[model samples]
Target: MAQLDISSSAISIPTLLIVNRYFDEVTSNIRERPMPWEGYQRASLITEQELLLLRNYSSRTGLKDQPTAEKYIDLFLILINKLSRMDALQYILVAFDDTIQKFPDTLVYLCQLEVKSEGSPFNTLKRCLGKDDDYLNLKAAKIITDLLNHASPKFVQTFDFTDLLLWLNRQLQSENPNVVDVSVQILQGLLKLRSFRPVFYGKAHLMNIFMGLIQASREGNPQMLYQLLFCLWLLSFEPIISDSLDKQYGVISQLVAIAKGASKEKLTRIVMATLKNLLVTAPGDNLAAMVAVKLLNFCDNLATRKWTDEDILDDIEFIRQELTERFQKLSTWDEYVSEVESGHLSWTPSHQSDAFWKMHASQLAADRGRLLNCLAHALNVPNQDPTVLAVAAHDIGQFVKYYPLGKKMVQDSGAKQKIMELLTHPNADVKYRALVALQVLMSHAWDQ
Candidate 1:
């Protein structure tokens, strides 16, 4: 929409032009050719002169005629509701897409019309989403996206987009790359609307789709990957979504992997921005999770590279500094918990700190010895890192020496037998740690 003084809105005109042209380019090919007037007349829809006027409206701009716009909208609704023929419907949709984009008055006018029943133009387009033809579905989605972009707050609040949002969710998993791309781009736009966030987020399968796309995009689809990450970047603005993304969906590891290998500058920029948002939104265990995934190391490496985008560098610097500061602030127990939960343990300070074990051993024994059981599982897993086995064995011994029921807990967790078997391990570090832990388990007077 433009202001009464066109000069005031001149700066935004170019951006508007780009958006309109892009929609025109990606919409159905039916817009290029003339409609089958003979077939439409055979179906008794409209006269030849009326079709010509509609065609003119499609190409015309700056249309300020209210009556003409309403007439065209009614025609589109009639064609959409009455016409079962796919091509005819597509022709009408192509016209609708053009008219609404070029003529602001028509878009505003259409949005103002209240929907009284299912056969409304908006609802009709929604129904087209279920059509078997991908082109029709795409056109329908584009129109819906366009409407929502300009629709009044009242209309958006009352409208039920659950079906449409679910369809978009399913379409993200589509094998067809174009469908997935368009769907993500639509979602990216929709998420910009604050009211739409909870609606889309409420869908149970949204995160699952994101997880799959994050994994799939790693196989070399930069456009799809960027678009998918863009949606995540938008969603990360919400504190609740950001929290769930890391805690429940485990997206930090996947996103970190993408950021680590992003070839395109834009891809790296978005991934960095998203990681930054997720980090800043909630930074307790989330920070630990990022650190455990070696994101800080990645940020360190990223910081050394020459980045053109200032935002990218800023995000990298911020994340690196935040991870570093918070990591230092993390308690010995928090560090130990992060390492064990990451499933990639190493010889960190916690494993050897006598005071750490003495202080947190009972805390580890608090959750029914959950952290202890995790260590026992890591110890028994075949082909685990010898350092990890060694660390696990040492922690078990420390737990036994500190906690009253640590020995029985180790036996219950099956780590006692695993530790005994590890005494014959090929790695000397693992064998020695196993022997010490076994002695502690047997209540022997072993030296610290």
Candidate 2:
């Protein structure tokens, strides 16, 4: 086994004294055991007296004043090193509780030691396993795993593990591209241990925390955005100990909102990647489709003339494909259209005759103007496709004639300017259709 030279390490003088004494006790116990395979076999056996002495030493050293305690810790470590050689399996198991209970602070110090020693503790533990007779190595592995699972509240409060994670997240948000890259590498290491996951996931506000991180990346930190997006993707896909409804809702909703409002190109790309991940991993149900549709709507709204022609075509095609896939399983056009249009499932269709529209006439009036503009655009398509023109004219005429408030809304809406513009279009068919929609509005206005 590779031995660590704690003699020259930063371990305090008092700790060294305790460790050396414990080592002497363990060495003596090995000598008294029955002979087996020369030196190695002798080192493998531990006696009851040695176990009691080690436990007493552990308790006393733990109770010593800080200065004395530091010196005693060094001694305890010496014993651990000697025991590592002897394969003192039962004694090591018995000693663990005392070591853990009596010297809680030691774990923190050891973690720092491990970090400074370039994973020396892990290496030593691994080597101890090489002697197949070393039950101590197996016990140590279990203890370490337990420590990770049972990370105490006091330990967390005193340490910066959580803060370190947050700091890394902040660094990722830095404008410096290199900082973001380094931050991601650091995060990868931190997340590798199973013990750390509960802490990461236990934050009741984790969803909000991640959302804030993503929002900060919208300016110029695309790399940070990507990292945050990937983190969220992992969290959503990772197997959690228990399903949490609130967390699921919070994470998905915040992600959808971010995808909709994010403006940076890289951030948008990351959001799209996250959305694709969700679509693939999430169940094929109404809730999932609703989220997918919301993202699609946001994408549709952001798809502008400023985008390259190819981009526009691609955007449209993507939306079309998703909608087609989502609607294909539905049994009816109305159900499918409702879902596509609003991204919500309608468990039951309304039987009332648009009564809500009548009750909120003024509110609907404001929206009615935009609907008319959409109607005008559909009617004025250059080709004047007969089917489209008929649908546009029919819907517009019906709305105007059936609803008394519709004519009043149009007159008050300042849609007259848009109507005039449409009337002067170059295509006679388009011009004629615009005139017809206007005449319908006018006839309704006169009746009113």
Candidate 3:
């Protein structure tokens, strides 16, 4: 007879309460603390009948009765009592591997079982990262990532993200780019953990996680770059993170390089989205200004992006609008170098809008940068769009003629060369507009 650890009172067979009573009796004296590897040992902990049941279940190529298997939940309870460190880890790892293979149809159900436990397969996998089976470690890491991506937060949070990040960070130093890439991907999964936060993953002794992420963006791996950019997009939501990226590493510049160099549509789109997230957080920020300038690199070929993916096009448009709005609000009077160069109008308004105290002269004259940027954009891409060039040149003419210290500062912007380039333009109206704008800006020289 299989003896209970404690005595059980007999009750009717088919009821759940009676079953619990019997289970309580069986396990009451069972050891609460298990040795790790005890569960993995060939010497099974459950009754002979239970062992025979599992043996019968294992013999079949398929699961005939999954619910009946569930009824044998005491397998875990018994192991939790008897398993030691090594065997417990080995048990879960084998179970994870077998569950994936044996129950392809029950994957979600089976993975959920491991995911919600602190001692689950991935926790064991994390420990194995420094072990000799790196290939298996990566394979297991990938499986864990896929599981965590789909797992519920309640289950995902059960894993310790800090430890996972530290392990993955160490793996980033692998000689194989594929290894580094997989490690980066696993770190991406760590970001999705419910309790995950953006604490710096440590550079005091080793390469910090964010540094690795930034470096990956600049390196040649598109897959790694995509995952890194995705994390940055999420991290950018936090002020501490966004500010650290800007103030400490100037990561925004690296992101621009990545976006500019990326040939893949998906890679470019994520890089673009990541930049947008960073810029949107503090539009008036210094890095925002640099990023705004960096973003202009695309202006010369904006049409190529117009036919790109709809999602990327939307991101481009968002960046465009935000930059335009932010720059408009940024005072440009301070940037005007005319009077300082010409030694006239010794003092200018502190505000660009105040430059138009002579209201109705032209809004363009009030902000010199806006007019210069407008003309530059037109002259670059609107080479054939004459009306764009015309309006832009007309704005420059007004800015040069009416704004304080206009001619000197406008000339200092290299406006003369742009105007000369347009003078021979094929479109008569565009040529005329450039000619007029230049005449106004250079009128002082003619007068002198």
Candidate 4:
């Protein structure tokens, strides 16, 4: 894979500058096309002085005073509120985009001025998001991003981003690469606000967006991958969100895959960092899940690499150390529980260990044959793995041999019936395992 040089700053840029430089280069350069009739009509709304203000690409410091900057904002808002044509509206938004990027102080001025109408600056931007045009929505989203980046906490709390958030979520699935990139960028920026984190996290489409970005990472766009991972990294800081990152979503597996083949240092850094946070913030079940997915091996592999970044090295060592300590603490029964809960059965060493069955088989019967029931459920699942069926049957048979009430438990749990049905399994190993378990179930304890 070809490697890309990703700036460390790209992942952790300051909030005030997030929408300024990092995003503008990729987001603002929409393709040039001929102006529509509405473009000409909207152009007429701009007075010569206002047009001059739009043309001037100078810094905010170059403006004479505060009132001049306010006048400039007033003109931009007037044009934005009045423009209905997509082409003309996009052009005005583009100019405002340049204004915000070049002159951030304009945000402060615009924030202070409130027009008395439905078409206020914030409302106008929100309305623009409802348009069908991706580029138009992108510009509107960028303007919103800049405002949010610099907006006061009071402003943030008072404003409703419900619809805008929904629009951004929909944009994540856009065909335009720029649209997807900016959507993630805006989302990442939005999530930085501590109060806004839960709002975005609470969205019904949150997990779908995550899965989509994870799938997109496989396409090998480093920047897109980094932005998506950065959002996950941010989400990991909140324990609630971190705990809910279920193993079933294949999130940990996908991230491990990314770490294994990541060509950029920044990419490796963020992936490991995210996994490390998830390990600590999530519960023991999640920890067991990490081990279940072989994250430990990936950590060991990362530990051997000659990493130039100390943070990456520290993160790798921390994950390896934590995984090792946690794995070491897992008792045989706990290991067995983790395996059973993972819904995948195999002939791990515990399955063949005579001592394991002697020590833990009675425990399986303790919780009303809960573990045995899980094993049976695994057996009963449609089109289950042959190996899983074989091992599940073997475990149930071992349970019956070691525990006095194990036969009754298995019979009651329907495990014996499933095992009997599996005696005719297509796979030789499965049929054989099921036969052995069936014989054990049918025989008396005195016979042994």
* TM-scores of all candidate predictions against the true structure: 0.78, 0.33, 0.51, 0.77
Q: Once model 4 is optimally superposed onto the true structure by TM-score, how far is the C-alpha of residue 343 displaced, in angstroms?
A: 4.4
Per-residue error for 51 in candidate 3, Å, reads: 6.5
Residues 1-448 of candidate 4: C-alpha lDDT, one tens digit per residue: 1211221112222223333343465344532333443334466855666545654523234455556656666766787776677766776676666656556677765655532342367876887888988777867876776666556666666667787777877898777666777678777776665556657777758667767777777676887788888887777766777777754454676788787778788889998888887887885647655755677887887788897888898988988888888889888778788878766566778998989989888988766777878898888888888998999999999999888878878889988888988978999999999999888877845564
Clashing pairs in 4: none
For 1-448, candidate 2 gives per-residue lDDT tens digits of 1112222212111111111233335444643444222343345434444444444454444345444443444444444555543544344443443454455665555555555764344344444433444233333443443333233434323433443444544454556544444444444333434335455666546545556666666567655666666555444433451134223343444555665665655455544544443544443432344432455556566565353334334544465467557656654333423332222222222212245324432332344465555445544445544544443443454456556767665555444445557566666654665587688788876786
Residues 76-167 of candidate 3 have per-residue lDDT tens digits of: 33443444444343443334444444434333553556756634545545555444544445544655555555455565555455555566
lDDT of 1 by residue, 1-448 (tens): 0112211211111102212333456454576766666666766777676667665666664245667666777778767876777877788787776666656666556666644443455777888898877667877787776666667666676678776876786687778766776677777666666567766777768767776887888897887788778777777767777777676666787787787688789888888888887887766547656756788888888899897788888888988888888878877677778887755677777778888877888877778878888888888676787987888898889989988777777888998888999988999998999998888877633332
Model 3 error, position 187 (Å): 1.6
lDDT of 2 at 20: 28
**Which pairs clash in model 1?**
none
Which 10-residue window of candidate 1 scores lowest in summed lDDT?
Answer: 6-15
Better of 3 and 4 by TM-score: 4
| Worst 10 contiguous positions by lDDT, candidate 4 | 1-10
What's the lDDT for all of these models?
0.73, 0.46, 0.52, 0.72
